[model samples]
Target chain A: MMRRREARLGWLFISPAFFHLVVFALFPMGYALYLSFFKWHLIKDVRQYVGSSNYAFCLTDETFLHSLWNSAKYSLLSVPFGMALGLAVAILVNQKLRGISIFRTIYYIPAISSGVAIAMLWIYVYLPETGLLNSMALGLLGEHGRLTPMVASMLGKPDWHLASIDFLNSTQWAMIALAFMSGWGGLGPKMVLFLAGLLGIPQSLYEAAELDGAGRWRSFVSVTLPMLAPTTFFVLVTSTIGALQVFTPVYMMTKGGPDESTNVVGYQIYQEAWVTFHTGLAAAESFVLLALIAVVSLAQFRMMKSTLVGYATT
Target chain B: MRRKTWDKVRGALWATGLYALLIALAAFLLAPFVWMVLISVHPWNTPIPAISDLIPRGPDGQVHLDWSNYGLVLFDPNLPVARFLFNSAFVTLTVVVGQTLVSSLAAYGFAKLHFRGRELVFALFLGSMMFAGPVTQIPVYLLLRSLGWLDSYWALVVPGLSSAFSVFLLRQFFMQIPAELDEAARIDGAGDFRIYARVVMPLSKAALATAAAFTFFGVWTDFFNPLIYTNSVEMRTLEVGLSIYKNSYGGSNWPAQMTAAVIVMLPLLVVFLFVQRYFVKGIMLGSIK
Candidate 1:
């Protein structure tokens, strides 16, 4: 009798969350899958049954392909750099010293700020004239800098001649600039995760390594690196997924500008659905992105599993 | 004695290098916000100041501060800054409270209740985390359109009431609470709801605060949903409002735009400053496990 009541209460407790999941999450996914097969436009109220044509169109679409490639390139550039900088900062701040929390707080501020705000700030930072980046680069390169003239001469075109290159307008540098901004903004949260992982590492492990005459670098490589495998894995997977879905910066800063060089798959979906009102094509593209993420995540899990097992035996 | 001296020299060198690196990283993280503040107070109708001239001079060669930018942005006819702020606050508060209550209840059930298919239900909730936002963006918009909820607060608040990530985080924390407390409460004839409300909730304050902070931060800073759902200036949140301002008057009034940006960003920064420990603890709890 009590068991029955307990189960009843359990069902009651979960009903609210379950309702939201069905309405907001699961149902939308199901509806998206269903809608992908039809040609639908919300504004025009046009719905026609077109079986797999949307998917076929996406497959052959050059814009879609380029956006996918852009997303992949973005993920490649940001994830590793973000992780490395995060880990470096984490190690630096992990030291037992005075006023370390101040440094941690400074690093974490960008992570908590609005994405649009960061994007806006970076827009100013990347402006060609009087922007922070160009000013700093000019200062670093000195008067008539070697690399500036070299880059200008390499292009060898009269139009390409410039004292300082425009970071956002130039196709060659836009994606890289965006990636650096993302990596910098993302460093805080990633560092916090690494710091947490670092704190969890037992001090005795380092002591034992010291007793064995191991240097600091050796202990870090063997002890700290292996123990942090799980944190590293988690950060890698989450950050890669985040990089793949990046939209706000692209929208706010570049609008995928300077010849569509910065157009990412996520922004492409937005434009298709909202701007062009091609809901069916947008849905198909979303599914394509879903499939790509699943494959990459599963591959990462499999690769990490073998390495984790290797560490366990050793 | 010689060996000790060599070790001391190396240690001092390492400390200096570490401090140098830390300062450099801090500057990289903070320079933009510093510049934003400087530019916001900079006198209008001047060229964008150099890094050296952060505090620009007026035509009179006196250091004239431009406090008018804040007034201009706040009182702008097109922007509706106060209304947007109120909208953002309302939406953020509702989502945070609703998500906390719903996720906590579900977490309690998952942590303590022995119902059939419990593991399966939890697994399903976890699986939903991998569903990217784009996958659901259009369908949810369509669903809202059918329900006649577009350009309304219901569109923002209702769909965001439950989060799988919050549920997972709370469930982990709930599981760590001793079952003996629940049993003791039961012995006193307190039912499951009573124990959940009185016993479990009180003991899980740290986790609850962390979850609330995370939800607050996420909702307050979210731009994508607000942009899509709201059509008019009256309904826009602070993020979308600020972006609209940037799009419209960005070139002519750079200081006003920076002022608006700073205003939008200030609240979360203040909240973060006060309860920073909880924020870090919350992040650690969510990620490390």
Candidate 2:
């Protein structure tokens, strides 16, 4: 009798969350899987049962391929650089120096700010003539900055001007510029996570390393790096997922412009679903993305298995 | 003594290098924010200021502070900045409260109540986290449309009311609380709900606050949902509204755009300043386990 009553109460307690999960998450995911195999138009409301044609269409579609390439490129460029820079800064700010909290706060500000706002801010920062980056580049490589003539001569193009290199306007530099901004924006939270990981390492381990005459560099390589593997693995998986789904920046800043150079998979999915109203195609493309993310995440897990074992033991 | 002096000299060099690197990183991180503030106050109609001019000087060669950009952003007849702010605050608050309540209750069930199929249900909930947002985006939009909740607060709030991540986080925290308290409460004739309400919730304030903060920040900064769902100008959240504002008047009104950005970011920045420790702790807790 008591067990039955407890079971009833448990079910009652969890029903609300279960309802939400079914309504929002589980139902939608199932519906997405169903929709991926059908021909559904947003406006018409008539769903034709098409078997695997949407996936077939996505495979052959050049724009889909390009966007996938773009997303993969972005993940490749942003994830490693963001992790490295974040780890470097975390180590820097993790010191016992005075007022380190202030620096930590400033670094983390961008991560907490709205993505659209950050994109808006970066628009001005990346502005060609009067922007901060170009201005700095010009100062460094202009006629009087001493390196200007050498760079110009090396390029062997008299028209090569540092002031006119529009970071967001050109096809070659647009994706790279977005990657740089992403790296910068993501630095804070990544650093914070690393800082937490650094702090969690038992002080005794470091003391023992020092007692064994392990220098700072050697200890960092053996103790700090191994201990931090779990955090690094977590960051890698999450950031890879995040980078693949990069949308707001592309939407707010470039809108997949400059000859479709910045059209990542996430933005492409949005465009397909909303702009072209190809709901079925969009659903299929998202599945492809899901598959890719799963594959990459699995690869990361396999590669980092040894380090994770270290984490488990100590 | 001589060798110790050399070591001291090396240590001094290391400290100097570290400080220099830190200062440079600080400047890199903060300079853009400082520039945003400076440009927001600069006269909108004038030429873009030179890099050397951190603060713009008027044509009279005197320092002039122009508050017109802020005025334009806040009171522009077409923009509806205040409405967007209200919508964002309303939706964010609802999600924060609703998610915290629902997630905590569910967490309590998972953490304290032992019943049949408990582990299975919890595993299903955890599995839901693996499904990324885009995978479910279209279906949810369609579901909301069918419910006739499009372009309304229902579309924004209802779908986001319960988060798997929040439930997971709260469950982790709840499991750490000793079961003896609940057992003691049961001996005192308190029911499960009563124990949860009076005992578990009180002890779990930090966890609850952490969940609330994450939900608040996520909902506040979310642009993709608001962009896709809310078509009407009044239904728009601040992030989407600012993006629309940028699209329409960004080129001619750079200062006003910056002002609008500042307005959108100010509330969260203030909230973060007050609960900075909880925010960091939440990140640490969420990431570590």
Candidate 3:
């Protein structure tokens, strides 16, 4: 009787949340999977059964494949460099310096700021002549600045000044620009995580390294890098996942333009669902993304478990 | 003694170099925000000034500043930005409060209550976190559309009212609270609800605040949900509304665009400055495990 009463009260406490879980999370996952096997239109409110075609179409679709490729390129461009910068900054700020928290807070501002606002701000930053980067590249005094002509002459493109490049409008530079911004915005959280990892390292290891006649650089390589393996792996997995799902910057800035150069999978899925209104296609595309993420994360997990953990334990 | 003096000199040099590097990195990270703020104060519809021209100089060559864009962006009749701000504030607050309360209740059940299948249910919640948003967004949107909740606060707040991560976070915290306290409350004729409310909730304020802070930041800066769900101008949240404001103003109106951007970003920065401890704690709590 007492157990029955406890179970009844437990149900009462969890029912509201359980209701939400059923309605929002579990139902949606099942429903999305169910919908992927058919052709559905939101406006027409029609669904037709089609076996395996949605997945098959996604696999063969050039635009979808390109988007997946772009997402991979974006992850490669952003994650490693961002993690490097994050580790560098983490090591820099881990010292017992005065007013260090202020710098930490300042570095973190971009991460917490509104993404759309950041995208808009970056559009201005990447503008041809009036943008911040171009202005700096052009020597900050408009076109008459000395470095523009000098650098242009040195690069054998005497007519081509840095200020003349429109980053978002050029297919070659668009993805790189977006990746750079993402790295900037994502650095803070990665840095903080690395800082935590740094703090967790045993001071005895460094002392032992010094006793073995290791210098600062040698100690960093032999001791610090090995100790940071797990943290590095964790950051790597999370940042890669984040880079794959990047949306606002592309949506606001590029709209997958400049010859579909910046059409990431996240934006591609958005276009599929909302713009094209191909609900079934979008569902299938998203499941493909889910599978890709699962595969990548599992691969990384296996790699870490086999190699990094072994190194750390030995 | 000479060697000691040389060591001190080298140490001093190293510290100076480190400080310089830190300051430079800080400036680099902060420059875009500073540029946004400076440009927002420039007069409306003007050509964006060069770096040398950034310091606004009127025709008379006197240093000048324009504050009109703030008024224009906030009170622009066509934009309805103020309404968007209010809508964002309402939805964010409601979701934060509702999610925290519901998560805590469920967390309490998992932490203290003796029930069959408790572990399984909690595990399900944690497992659901791995499901990507894109995989489920379409169905949730369809669900909202079916209920006629799109373009309204219901669509925004209802979908966000329960989070599994928050439940997991609070459950971890609640388990650390001594069970003796609850037992003592039970011995004094307090029911489970009272023990939960009067015992658990008050003691778990730090964890509750951490969960709420994370929720606040996530909801406030959210662009995807607000963008797809809301169709009307007035229904837009600040993040989406800021983008819409930028679109209509056209790219040439840098000053006006920056103003809207600043207005959208400033509140979060301010809130973050004051409550940054909670933010840091919340971030580190999840990752360092």
Largest TM-score belongs to which candidate?
Answer: 1
How does candidate 3 score on lDDT?
A: 0.88
For candidate 2 chain B, the 10 contiguous residues with the lowest summed lDDT are: B45-54
Best candidate per DockQ, number?
A: 1
Model 1 lDDT per residue over B206-261, tens place: 89988888898999999899889889889999999899877887556667767877
List the candidates ranked by DockQ, beginning with the highest.
Answer: 1, 2, 3
Task: Please state the Cα-based DockQ of model 3 relative to the true two-chain complex.
Answer: 0.70
> Across residues B1-289, which tens digit of lDDT does each residue of candidate 3 receive?
9999999999899888989999999888989888988898888988888898887878899988888999998998888888889988999999999999999999888888889988888777866776546688999999999999999989999989989888888887888899899989999999989998999999988889989987888999999999989999889998898888778888989999999999989888888887676666666666644
Alpha-carbon shift of residue A207 in model 2 (angstroms)? 3.2
lDDT (tens digit, per residue) of candidate 1 on A50-119: 9999999999999999999999999999999999999989999999767889989888999989887787
Model 2: what TM-score?
0.94
Q: Kindly list the per-residue Cα lDDT of model 2 for residues B1-289, writing each as its tens digit.
A: 9999999999888888888888899899877888888888988655556788757778898888798888888888997988998999999999999999999999999988889999998888977786557698999999889999999999999988998889888888888899899899999999999999999999989889888988988999999898888899999999999888788975667787788888888998998786666767777777755
Angstrom error at residue A95, model 2 = 1.0
- Per-model TM-score of chain A alone? 0.92, 0.91, 0.92
The 0-to-1 C-alpha lDDT of every candidate, in the order given, reads 0.88, 0.88, 0.88
lDDT of 3 at B1: 100
